[model samples]
Target: MQPIALITSPFTDKFSIPRQPGLAPSVISTVSFVGDFDHTASIEGIQQYSHLWLIFEFNQHRSHQWRERVRPPRLGGNKQLGVFATRSPFRPNNLGMSVVKLVDVVVKPQIKLVVSGADLLDQTPIVDIKPYVPYVDAIPEASSAFAGDEPNQLEVCFSATAEAFIDELTSNAAKSEHYQNLRQVIIEVLRQDPRPAYHASKQPERHYVSQLYDLELNWYVTGQCLTITEIRQQKDF
Candidate 1:
């Protein structure tokens, strides 16, 4: 299918993205229509809905071969399950769907949508967009064996230097409003302990780097606490 739009997300790479939408509600994204789909009239009634379903392609994994059996992150990425049973990006079509909150719809300045809780990567192609109808989309009797409940979250903390850096970034009036909630976004993402299951088990004390927006986060885990050692702009690296 042809892409109707493309999304610009805070997640620059796959490592720091939440396993599911709404897991990190502060992460926002912008969907810009493209080609013939860039008409404001096409999204005239979009504001009526509180949420939307974004049908996007897993473009990053399109080249990889699809697997019938895959390990789900929820199962610690150890147990194998059928691909259809899990939301693994490796699929025949490499397609993914996410439900994101509709923060705003800009019509005057072309067609653009401000959405929150998106799990899409930067410049991800969007094939379709649909309104999330709670009446039918949400099923009360839904149940899953592998993912029965939300995963446990770690305690996320920042070092004094990291805190000072964040304060400086938000201190400027030009960047303050845009970055006011950057700290919360980082906390939510880090608290989820976005590490490979094997790394968590084998190298719990190892330092790691994750990219969020244009910032590079240096962090490490000890016991149930994840600490941020430093935060740097990607340009400085």
Candidate 2:
């Protein structure tokens, strides 16, 4: 498929992103068209729909060998499920589909689509965009045996350093508005504990660093509790 656009997401690395679309509505992202795809005519009437279906490539997750069975993080990584049964990125096609809430469509010097609640990695190439028809797309009878429920939550607390860091960022008039909203982003993300399933229940002086927008998140987990040790702009890292 031809590339239509690329996503600018806060999830530069991947681990910090939500497991699926709509899980992190606060983490807004943008879709900018490549070349002629930016023509306003291409997106005519696209904003009429409340949500859109994104066909994007899992470009960075290319795999050398295909595996018949894959470990699902939601299953605690112990049980193996057929690759076709899970949304594992290591596939032959490496394609991903997501439904995201369309916030707005901007057209001026360049055309840009602002959307919320996407799980795509930064710089993910988009193949196509389609409006979601509620009549057919919202299937009430759909069910997933294991993936139906939301992710388990962990208690999140910010360390003194983390709190101070947040204050420092939000205190600046230049970035206060954005940083204020980012506080919850930190809690919600850490509350889900993005650690690998195999690393569960282990706290051996481990610290995880992740990025969101221009901020860098440094955190650690203890039992069911997570503490944000620090959060600073990407430049300081």
Candidate 3:
């Protein structure tokens, strides 16, 4: 039997998408189908699952030929390691995987999905989608080799104006759910400090605006301390 797949993304461009899922929960993305595959029946029972495993192509990095070993940013980009041991985009197949939250599915003119915690760039081609089974797939004892233990605790402070903006956005009934989730997601990602480790010594104050779906986030970093200064609707961007 021949294998078939579809690709789609909710991001408008690569600049807005997170490098990893759960890193930006406020970042919502879409996963649509290709041609004839666009239909509700294709995902008839998907709503029952809260999360899913997305198999997609690393289309942007396809030009790079596969290598036996590659460097991982998580390891500070200094050591070369086996390709399978890392989530490097440079691979023989240029494939990528992400576990994402399933927000909703719309079927009308075509099958369109609204998902959260997506790490794929906008318009990314989805190769496959499978329901995430927490019972069987969640391995608490599994070890994260080389990735090392989770990083140290980081501080996050919000400016008064930024807090006010978040309050307003969350208070709005139409966007409360999106606002709350996005806030938490942004905070979590910032705590990890997405910048390169080598740049840790550079304490320059920098600002970040991250968005997913309806929520827009404005944040900044000063030394080891980070601040989420604002949250609003994407339209505000």
Candidate 4:
């Protein structure tokens, strides 16, 4: 099938979309459809679905060929497993499926969708969209192997400098709400630890940076733990 258009957002790069949505609710992103189309009419019944299944291109891996076996991050980045068993992006089709919360839809010259918990990078091509059905999709008894039982929560403390910057952003009338939610989401996602398990032994004082929306995060690793020390707008990067 021919791709209709590309969809871009500011929430993350190709590497940043979490394995699943709701894992980071503070991250808000917009999907802008490209090219000429009846944006308003195409999304007429979209509001009816609380969630949407986004079939998007794994643009980062598009140029790379697929591998039969892959290492899963949850498996500590070691040992090989059949590619089909893991959600590795290095696939033959270079496609990704993510279920995201459809918060709002605005129709103008082009359809702009406000989505939450999206794992797609900016300018990624959207292949398709499908409504999620609770009856057919919910599987409470399903088991998670490498994912373990429940997610481990981390303690997060921001540096004074980061707090002050956040305060200034929050005080701004135009960006207060967006900045507040963005800060919380970025903190939560980074706190979960994004480092590869094999790289866990690296220097603990090193800092890592990640961009979400307009925020640029400066985080540090301590005792194999991750912490956010600073957050600033991307313009400052």
Candidate achieving the largest TM-score: 1
TM-score of candidate 1 to 2 decimals: 0.97
- For candidate 1, write residues 16-42 as lDDT tens digits: 789888988998789999999999779
Give lDDT per model, in order.
0.90, 0.83, 0.70, 0.73
How many steric clashes between backbone atoms does each model show? 0, 0, 7, 2
The CA-based lDDT of model 3 is what?
A: 0.70
Which parts of model 4 have CA positions greater than 4 angstroms off? 12-16, 148-150, 177-180, 223-225
**Best-first order by TM-score:** 1, 2, 4, 3
At residue 146, candidate 2 shows an lDDT of 95
- How much does each candidate deviate from the true structure in C-alpha RMSD? 1.4, 2.0, 4.2, 2.4
**Regarding lDDT, does 1 or 2 come out ahead?**
1
Local accuracy of candidate 4 as per-residue lDDT tens digits, 44-67: 788999998888888788689999
Which regions of candidate 3 deviate over 4 angstroms? 1-19, 160-185, 202-220, 228-237
In candidate 4, position 80 carries an lDDT of 87
Instruction: State the lDDT at 168 in candidate 3.
Output: 76
For residues 43-116, write the lDDT of model 2, one tens digit per residue: 88887899999999988866556678999889988999998999988777888899999998889878989998
Residue-level lDDT tens digits of model 3 in 31-127: 7665667766788899999999988887788678998998776777679899999888888888889999999887876577788777777667787
- Maximum-lDDT candidate: 1
**What's the CA error at residue 98 for candidate 2, in Å?**
1.2
